[model samples]
Target chain A: MSWRDGIVLSLRSVVRRPARTALTIAAVALGTGLLVALASIAVIAETRVIAQLGKGGPATAITVDANVVDPAQIDSDTPRLGTAKPINAETLRSVKQLPHVSTVTTVQSQDVYVLPPPIGSALSGYTGDDPDRGLARPYSDSAIGIDFKQANNLPITVLAGRLPAEGSTSEVAVTLGYFDHVHLDPNKPAAVLGQVIEIGSPQVSPDGQTIRGRWSRGVIIGVVAQDLGSGGLVTSSTLTNAQRAWQLAGGDGNSFGLPLPASTYSSLVVVADSLDTIHTVRSEITALGFATTAPEHLIASVQRYLQVVDMVLGAIGVIALLIAALGITNALLAAVRERRREIGVLKAIGAHDRDVLRWFLVEALICGVSGGLIGTAFGIATIAVVSHIVNDYLVSQGLLGVDLGGAPVATSLIGVAGAAVLALIAAAWPALRAARLPAREAVGAL
Target chain B: MLGSDAVARGVAVSVRGLQHEYGRGRHAVPVLRGLDFDIEAGSHVALQGPSGAGKSTLLSLLGGLEPIREGEIWIGETRLRGLRRGELAEYRSRVIGFVFQHFGLLDVLTARENVMLALSLAGIPLQQRMRRADEILDDVGLTDRAGHRPQQLSGGEQQRVAIARALSSRPHLLLADEPTGNLDEESAERVLDVLERLRVDNGCTLVVVTHNPMVAARATHRLHLREGRLAPELVGEPA
Candidate 1:
């Protein structure tokens, strides 16, 4: 008999036995729905994390920390604090010469107050003499230090006037946030160019390890783009003079109660020529006793973790499906036994054993497909309800991520197909038994 | 083995020294002890026997449903003993049709579907099945009851449906076992009438296992099975 005939025969049987078919479908649906729901959650989680990590920062930008050792632990050599080798001019020089290191700039912070702090300024609501107190300063907010001679090392884009010319120690640049700190309109960065500004002395330590000096003056020759993190104090080409002025203002190595072996950078921002070179460059920098971090690297780590969880969850779903397949086997074997006479009639009427097998397998196939579709719809609906509950919870808790929908169609389809294939496998033995049924006994069976 | 006489005038079904047993090893019980028999082509033959006399076994052997463990069963020029399982199935589907005593109709299928299924099993093309099924249903006077399932039809009508299914493919050999045993007297006569008339019209050989004398009376020839051996055949005109 043709497979179509077999399928039609199988369909008639399915229609005849509604309760049995419904129970089989329900078993399959339970497994498939569980799988789809778990898979959708995984998809949403992955999408959320990836989107979060993909911010304005490009993946090619690697931030190199001065310390490789974990800061959360204290070493015996430093009784009270964790310590690691610092990034200095020597290491910076070596990094700049590395292959594919397109650009590298060291950022340093300045803790100084503008004399007669401007009114309604960052110095607002504070009366403390200690610079480290809640009292805020203009340059304290945007640590300014860059090698203005190199285009790649410019801490900020020159918004008006110009960056300091090479070897020009008297000229300085400030960020838009510095203007905000001084209570000046941020839009007026250009108006302050060429105006002389005095930086007050930083507070000295009680241990006499630091010495306070008189205020230092520099001409603001340039304004840089961005709200913060542009150079607020000095230029790298004129490093010694700037350091001498900062030291005179009591901003020496021992000023902040932390002993520095030498002048150290706060951090280094390294830019690779392209995405392909970023990893190698980061690894090379890390080998030099510095911690390396990049947006793409963090994303890769999260993805690795998420993949394991997805596999684990998917495996649980598969186990459920396997159990469902067992149900199929049980139901179909019973069918074969109960329908022995029917089988006999078919054979007596000239039906081949293979035709009998095909009919039973077609019945199983129907259950698998119908159950899979219903389960998928159920899963999508479950995801919707789950998303609503979860998103509502998140909103109440004031967390990121808006609405969670989009249940990866391709993965769901593959899962449904897999379940159906498994059902076919489960039905094979029963189908074979039916197909090999003897016409003699089957025809005579009551 | 067949005698030299089989070449002289061929028979529709020829059996010689056939031996069949059931179970296996210690539990194996012999059912049909050496039996030899023949039925003419285009004739209706009734196989009358006591219960457990191996009448159905003999019919199954002749129709190639069971393997010939000892002797030979020949349908036309083909030997049933040496045929492979697949070949035997083909032989049964193409060369022979069977009607069981219980009116072995698929309960899930309608009367027309039952007959159509038989035609399908006989390897009829898909396009001709509907017309062929309708023709067979009409022949059995089941045209109005074609849409009724086995449970919905009376025993007489169900038996006619089974008979229609057996004849639908027009197999060269028809082997029926107690086809009308479950039906009443009136239904039994109608079933016998259809079998006998279709037997001559289709020109296919027919052999039936039956306990009813009335069933045996409709056959052109008669044979009795006693103690797993066939009695001498009796010649008669179907009445």
Candidate 2:
């Protein structure tokens, strides 16, 4: 029979068994929907990260370090300074002078203490200097650092006041928790922003000896209102002020020797001119003996993880699709049996064997295509449901700095195409059964 | 004016020394033994017999739906007994029309659609199959019922659609197995009239197998079958 007639006839036949058709369609939808949802999460996660990284700088950029070496042993050699190295200003200056260096900055974190009866008897408040200021208070007992300009580029949002000036030794910024711990009276005009506070050094060394260190007093210029919960803190200043404070806090010469070698910052943020330049810049930096990468590379790494996840998900989905296909095959075979007397009648009336074969095959194709369309729609709705949960988790955890709706375009397209392929795959066995039926045998089937 | 040789020369279907047996060895049940017949083109014939006389089986062999066990059966130049399965199918599509007692119109299709399927399977062009389907339905008195599916039509109407489908390809021969066996007298006469007119209009050789004497009486000739062998031919009243 002509393809059109075959299609029409087949469609009509499928429509006759409404419940069976609906069940098959639902089966496809379940598989496709789960696949689409999982895929969308992966895409959204990648999108959020890349957006953050891109905001921080260009795509092709690198940080250079003279003391760059394996990080695993840096702690054993230097004692537990709490996990990150203080990259020296001289090293940063040298890299700043390197060719194609768009911008360069330095930061370091160290411990300090804040005095005055501790809030709720739980040790609170951070006393630290900007890495560029090098002002250290050994008494206050908190994380302190000279914040690089890059810190302002951080994904964290500021709640109140303003950023500390480029070279201001008279100011400091504290997270919202820092203010909470000090028990400072917010109603008192002088207790909140612009409040002058005395900062002191910590009580003892890692060896447990109470000893004197450096101290400084500065006004609070900005308060980061986020409750980061991780207790990470930052402070910043100009390069010259940082040098003076370093000298005051026992740093010697441009090469400050530590109990171990002072290597480099724990992580580096670099910006390249464009997406295309990221690879070239990364390779160039790698040649210079530094590990380097960009947002897309990190994204690719995440995608590799997603690929494994998808395989597991797809395997699960395929089983469901297969079950649906078997159902369709069963129904079609049943149709063949029930229609046997009719088949005999047709053959008796000049209907050829091929006519019967074509009729049944057309029926199968109709089921496949219809099920595919239904499944695709279901998958998109599924993605929407799952993405809501995933996005909420990300926002609540601060992983995603902002809420993004649904998923990217490519992710949705992949879902639809995948469903269509699955439907066609499921139709093969039934189509074969239909195409091979002999007129005599088929007529006898009943 | 015509002798048996002239009549045999005019035959659209000829079967000689036909034999059919089921199974093998000790279990072989002979179904047909040495049957012979010549049906002239444009003539209507009815085969009458008891249930086990192999009326259906003989019709099947004659229509090229089954292989012959022995001897020869020919429809025009295409050898029904000697042809391969594919060639036989092609022959059937081009030369034979069939109407079963149960009226085998596809239940899912409208009357017009059922007729179109036959023309389509015969390799008629897409545009022409529809028109031919319409014409055949009209000729079978099913024009007013074109849009009705098999279940929606009466038994007589369903059988009419079946006849339309069978003849839509304009086959050279019509093979009916009790075309009126399932119908009441009024419906049977109506169906028989349609079949007679179709045979005349198409110059088709028509064969009907039935136990109904009235149906047999309308045939141009009658063949009495007893256990698959044809009795001496009997002249029947014309339709």
Candidate 3:
């Protein structure tokens, strides 16, 4: 018969026994739905984590450091030193003029002690300025003195207030942690936008006498934005102002300027032309005798963990699908036994064995596809619900400082396809058996 | 009384020293022994026998649905015993049509669609099937019942649908196994009438297996099966 006729006949055959058809479909749907659900969630989790890791990281920037290094490696042994040699500013100017070298930000870091807690909670040394507060620190990881004009070029997302003006010597944009520590209300404009933080020197001079250093000036030009992450801060201030204060305290103030001969940054941060440039730029930087840090590595580790999670979850989903498949096969086998007479009748009236085969397959396919579609939605809903709980927990813990990750569309599609393929595979044997029975004998069987 | 116009122009079917047995070894049941017969190009014949006399088995052999244990069956020069299942299926689709006692219509299909299936398997083009199916159903006096599934129709209507299906592809031979056995007297009469009409209109060679004397009486030739062998053939007028 023509394909249309075969399909129509198969459809009618299914309709004739509604109860049987429904049971079969339900079995397939359960399997397909469960599979889709797990797969979709896994996909979403992967995409979210990857996106968070900077899937769209920089492409073509070079990183220069004190030593030759593999940019991709995160040295567990090396300490996160507060003080590091700055990449020479003069070299940076020369590098900027290099073809394909678009932009560069010289990063200088030094360990600084700040009391954390309420601004005035404990005068016990520096309570609120606890260095262990992680990214919740009220200052940069190491105190970084930047030329406010050029420092704005660093990849800092200012949450509240505007960028410090290029020539503004008094203004500063603190990391989100500093903003939180300052207890600046986000609803209102940065009330501390133009306020100053006084930096006092504590060390004595080489002359062996306590030196009264002039307090450094800093304007609260910007507040750090909250991201769903644990810790880290990015802040900027005028290099000249910071240098002058350090010099007044008999410290190395010119370290903020062009580094001395043979000097290179202990750590370098480079910006790519676009999101696609992230990896390439990171690599190029690493190739330039500098170590590099990519959120991708962190993201990759998270993804590996998530992949295991998904595999376990997906296995559970597959088990459900397996059960559903068995159910369909069992149901169909039962129907085959019951409908021996019906099969015989069709065969007698010019229905080929293949026609019978097609009928059973069509039934199973319907069950699978429907279940897959429904299950995809089910999976997405599940992720959404769980994500909501995660988001709530984060908010409650006040830990929504950096984004962890999210679900995407590709994951759902994979889930649905996987479910469908499984269902079809499950139904194959039963359909064939039903088709190959001897017409006369099967009819007589009834 | 076999008419040239009733059969296709070639030797339609021949059976020689045919033997058939069921099961094997200790459980073997021999159904036919040295059975021999030749049906010409155009003829309507009836096989009459008591239950277990192997009437159905003989029909199965002739229809190429079963293989003879010994001897040979030739339908239009193709040997039934040597053909593979796929070849047999192709052969059945192109060369033979069948009607069973119980009407054997798929309950899910409307009368017309049941016939359409036969046409489809015969490889008729899609555009031609609808009109062709409708014509056959109308010819069987099932025009009004074309939209009704088998379950919705009476036994006679179902039989008529089966007959329509058998004739839809215009096969050279029509095989009926107790075609009217499941019907009431009136319904059986209607079915038999339809079969007779089909023979005249389509000029098809017809072979029917039945125990009913009335059915045998209606055939141009009557062959009796007793212990799996045909009795001397009897020629008769339409009952």
Candidate 4:
């Protein structure tokens, strides 16, 4: 028979038995939908995790510390005096001129005492009283200073307002950890923006027994996620101005009697041209007598873990499809049994065994393709609803939300093709049984 | 009894020492035992016998539905014994049409689709199959019921639709096994009339197997079987 005739016959047969066909199609759809949904979810999860990691800083960024000459001790943020050569203006210029080195930002930090707004102020309602201090009191904190012109290199997620203005010495951005330390509600961090706080530089008394504060007023412009440095972030000039003011007030040195270096920075953040150049740039920085650390190694470990998760989810989807294929085999076998007489009539009318096989196979193909299309649509809808709910929760928790845009086109096509091939395999035995049936016995003529 | 024009337009059947059996190795039951016969092209013949007399078995062998176990049967220039399974299927499509006693109609199809199925199996294209199906249905007096399914038609109409399906391909031979077995007297007469008219119009050989004498009486020649062989007295007799 012609292919058109086979298609028409198969379609009629499928439509004639509504309940069985519907049940079979529904089984296939559920299986395929689960497969697509799980696969898409895995892809979205991998992308979101990588994006979250990226929020800290570009994977190519390397933190260079002066006291850490060994790469093994790269993570130490504090400077150890007399260990390695300190990074200064010369160090910054030398690192910037290295191959693949895109830019460099100087970092410095100082201990400061912060005094929150008093009761009945704009932020007083959102701030809780410390058990040791009645309402508002000075608390010891650290302010990390970096070049605001190269601020993009910082690993920070701003939760409210903008970063401290490039050249504004009076502006500062506090970390979420600082809000928690100061008894401020991190969940409502926007309330703290625009509030003024007093920052004091520590100085030793002439009697050599007590410490006094050299205070300056600054405005809280933004709240950011915790990163490599703690407390608040400011322009390098801001911390330098505070330190110079303390020195001009007859303070000979810090509480430890160590002189502050006038020309050198505590550390330097070096940005590479791309992730491909991070390792080379880091090695060059380390060769310059400084320790370097980047996030590439951590990213690689995370990727390996996500790949395993993807494989597990894919296995579960394939298992579900196989079960659905079994359902298809069962349904087609029943159809062959019920249509024995019809098959006999067709053979009597000169239909070949191949013709019979083609008709039934066509029926199976229709079911598979229909189920695949429907299941793909169902999977996309499921992802939409799930991402919406998850994003809502993420936003409420004061974090960046995830965007999971349906499965990729290639993934969806593979899923549909997989369903179709499995269905064809499932229908093979039943179609063969129908094709090989003896015409005489099938028509009950003998 | 055959004319030269009918001989030119139809296929003649010759059977020599034909034999067919069911089962094997002592459980064997021979159905057609050394039967010999010749049928002229364009002539209508009837095979009448009691139940289990191998009437339907002989018809199936003639229609190429079963392989010849030990026999030589020829239709036109084609030998049934030498033909392979695929060739026999082609022979059935190109040379013969069949009508069963139960009015073998696929219930899912309309009357027109049922007729078109025969044309389709013959590898006819869709447009021509549709046109030829309509023509044959009209010839069988089923044009008005073309859209109705088998369950919707009466027994007489269903049998007529079967006849239309058989003739839709315009084959050289037509075989019917008890074409009127399930019909009332009037419906049987009507079905027989449509069968005879379409057979003459298509100029094809017609063979009918029936237990009813009324059906046998309508044929130009009759062959009566007893105990798997043609009865001597009724062999080659005119009805």
Candidate 5:
């Protein structure tokens, strides 16, 4: 028989028993829908996490800190009371000369007292010589000093305005965490732009009995998202100038009661030539008597965990599909049993065994195709709704919302094709049974 | 009214020492044991017998519904023995047609679709099979009931639809096993008349398995069976 004829016969047979056919298709649709949704969700999750890590820095970037006596305190931003090999200018030049070391930027961190902008003022928050009396509030925060020209190499996400311009000692950029500290609205970061704030450096009296603040005033030019390290960003020159003023005001200088050395920096951010050389470069830096940390190791660990999640989700989908396949086999078997005489009639009308087999297989294929398409649509809709709900929750928790993109086309195709192949397999035994039935016995003429 | 040149000449049937049995080994019970007979081409033969006379068994072997176990049976130039499963199916489709007592019409199909199904199975194209199905339905006086399913049609109409299906492929040999067995008297008469008219008009060989005297009398010749073999006195006699 021709394939067209076989399809017609099978379609008629399927339509003849609508209830049974619908139920079988529903089972397959549910299985396919669940598989598509779970697989798409896993893919979207991996993309979002990788995107988040990408915002921090390239995998080739590594952080180098002083070799502290306490290993547990390594990479910590807080000052420790231990003699350590400081990351000085000489160390920076040596690391820059090492193989695979592309670039190095020095970083300095220090505690500062910040006075907030006035309630209603122009760009300059100063009302008179006493800018503290015109402030809305006061907050204590740490200031991170780095080369403004190398700011792009560090992990900084600017939400609004621009970063401190190169070599602008009076300019600074606050972090989103700064909003909570100084009672500013983080949702509208632009409102805080162009507002002036004061960074105070403490100085000791001659008798070493009292301390006073020697403040350096600057304007906020931008807002940034927090990264692995704490504190807002300022130019290294600005920090040096503030310390010089405090020292000139009779400060005790360094904690060791010695002159503040311009050669020493708290840490160094080292960039490797490529991701492949990050390990080698970090080891070389450690050999230079420093502790190094690479974000690639953390990213790799996160990817491994996501892979496990993806496998678990995929297995769940496969299990559901297998159960649906069994349902198809059972339904087709019952159809064969009920249509024994009909099969005999077809055979007696001169249908070959393969023709009979094709007829039943076509019926199964129809159900599978229909179910697969419907399931793919369902899965896409589910992903959209789930993404929306999750984004709402994230926004409510004061975190940036994420967008889970559409379902992958290759995944949908695989799901539909898998369903078709499985349906054909499920119908094979029953179709064979129908084809092998004796025409005489089935027609009841024996 | 049906016009198709696919089967222009009727096929003559010859059976020689044909032996068929049920089961295997010691549990075997023989049917159509060593039966030998011949029906001329285009001749209408009535096959009559009492219960357990193996008349249906003979008809089945003749129709290629069952395997020929011992001896050979020939239809035209093709021998039944040693034919593969696919070849036998082809023979059944192209060389012969069968009308069963139960009508054997699929309930899901309309009367016209039932007829078109046979032509479709014979590898006829879609438009041609549809045209042939309508023509055969008209020949059986079921043109108006073409759209009706089996449940909607009476027993006689259903049997006539079966006849239309049997003749859709224009087979050279037509086999009827109690075609009017389930019909009322008037329905049976109408069904018999349609069968006889189609047989004559198409010039195809007709073999009817029946116990009714009226059915036997209408045939050009009659054969009666007793037990597993043909009765001596009723062999090859004019009805």
Candidate 6:
């Protein structure tokens, strides 16, 4: 018979028995939905973990710290000598010109913020700034002076306002904890945008005994999604140190040519051209007498863990689909038996055995495709619900540099198509059984 | 090579030393024993036999449904003995069509769809299949009942639908096991009349396996089967 007639006839046969067909379709759909959910979970976990690691540094970028020689290590009984030397300008210039080093962001200088209601509110009027707020414990954390040229390496999600503008000395994006300590909703970072805060900026001299700079006022412009832990604050890159702090803050407009040297940098963020060469870049930086920090190894471990999870989810989903495929086999087999006389009549009218077989296979295929589509939609809904629970937990745990929200659920089209193909494969046995039945016995008897 | 006029009058069916048996070993029961015959093209021939006389078995072999165990059967230029299993099916689709005694209509299909399905099996295109099907249904006097499924149609109507499907493809041969076997007097007469009209109009070979003397009387020639061997054909007035 013509393929067109075969398909139409198959459709008619399937539609003639609605209850049985629907039952089979529902079974297939259930299995497909489970598969989709599992695949989606694997995708979400891998994406979030990668994003979290990127916050420390881009997966391909390595931050190198200058090595300092301590006198105590040389002479154990000589007591203490001093701290290590920071990476110098010559070393910074050397690493920047390395092969395959696409771009560089020099992280020069670190600042301290006297976080109000600090670690523990003791109501002790230590600063006498807000005496009524006694236990106004002061919070202290390292604020990395960010250079906007390399901001792409940071996995920061802006929750409220924009990031500290490229050249705006007055704008600074602080961590959510800055507002959290004052009992305001830190989640609503936008509310604090343009608000002024008195920052206690105490700088230790080279002798490490003297302090400089009094309380400096800075305005909040952006609120990031995740806390940089030690509550990351990206100060305006234009104002890197106390020397240029006043001028860049738009107060004096002077000292525009002063360069912040790498000697005072907490650490430098160096971006490589590709992830595969991150190890080479790290080793190159180490040869320059500096310790390198890269998240590539940690990310690799997470990827391996996610692979196992995806396999398990895939296994479970496949098991469900196999069971559904069996349902199709059972349903189609019974249908073939019931339509024995019809098969005979068709053969008598000139239907080839292949046509009879194709009709059954096509019927099973229809059931599979319809079920897979419904299951995929069901899986998307499932991801929506599961992600809601997950994102809430991530928020409550104060996780660093990971916001699992905003990314849509990942639906694997191939997974759904696989379910359909598997169902057809399962139906092959019954279709062959129907085809091999003697047309004489099936029709001539009737 | 036969001329066009000779090919037109070429033997429609030729059976030589045809032998068939059932079961095996000690349980073997021989059916047709050394049966031989030649049927001219465009002729109505009826085979009449009592119950268990192997009339249906002979028709089955003629339609290529089964292989002749010890003899050769030729239908026009094609030999049925050497044909592959798939080739047999193709031969049946292109050259042979059957109308069963029990009115073997697919109950799920309407009277019209049954005819259209036959056209489809004949590899007719979709656009013209329905129109041809409707014409055949109209020929079998089932135009008003085209949409009525087999269950909804009466026994006479179902038989007519089957006849319509058997003739819809306009095959080279029409095999009717019992065109009027399951009908009342009036219905049987009407079906027989329709069969004769379609056979004459289409000019295809007609072979009927029947038990009724009246059906045999309507044929141009009648052969009686007794104990697996055909008796002499009783020739009627020449068409």
Model 2, A294-320: lDDT tens digits are 355554566577668667766766676
lDDT per prediction?
0.71, 0.61, 0.63, 0.78, 0.77, 0.71
State the TM-score, rounded to 2 decimals, of chain A in model 1.
0.50
* Interface RMSD, one decimal, each candidate: 1.9, 3.3, 3.0, 1.9, 1.9, 1.9
Q: CAPRI verdict on model 1?
A: acceptable
Q: Where is model 3 more than 4 Å wrong at Cα? A: A43-47, A56-307, A345-355, A391-416, A442-446, B1-11, B231-239
Q: What DockQ was computed for model 5?
A: 0.41
Best candidate (score: TM-score): 4
Q: Model 5, B126-198: lDDT tens per residue?
A: 8999899999999999999999999999999999999999888988889998888898999999999999999
State how far residue A279 of model 1 sits from its true place (Å): 5.3
- Candidate 1 lDDT at A235 equals 42
Per-residue lDDT tens digits for candidate 3, residues A129-148, read 35454222444233454444
DockQ (CA atoms), all models? 0.40, 0.34, 0.31, 0.52, 0.41, 0.47
Pull out the clashing pairs in model 5: none
Residue A107 lDDT (model 3):
56
Candidate order by TM-score, decreasing, is 4, 6, 5, 3, 2, 1
| Model 1 lDDT per residue over A1-446, tens place | 87767887899888787898899999988888888888887886676435322321223356665666343421211122225557788889988888878778666544455542322233334443445654433333223555554433332445566777766655666655556554556554566666666564454545546545346565777765521133455444454335534544443345464332243665677776654566677768766766655656555677789999899987998888888899899999989888887887677666777788889888999999888888888888888898888865643332332446657787679667866887799999999999998877654642
Model 2 docking category: acceptable
Ten contiguous residues minimizing lDDT sum, candidate 5 chain A: A51-60
Angstrom error of the Cα, residue B73, model 2: value is: 1.1
For residues B1-239, write the lDDT of model 6, one tens digit per residue.
Answer: 22233346677877778888988889999888888777888889988778777888888888877666888787887788878767877888788878898888876678898888888888889889989988999898889999998999988888888888888888778988877888898999989998889999998989998888788778886767777888655433232
- What does candidate 4's lDDT look like per residue over A215-262, in tens digits? 767788887663445556454556655664574454445555534444
Question: Which candidate do you rate higher for DockQ, 1 or 2?
Answer: 1
Tell me which of candidates 1 and 6 scores higher on TM-score: 6
| Residue A326's lDDT in candidate 1 | 92
> Which candidate order results from sorting by lDDT in descending order?
4, 5, 6, 1, 3, 2
lDDT of 4 at A8: 86
Give residue A168's lDDT in candidate 3 (0 to 100): 60
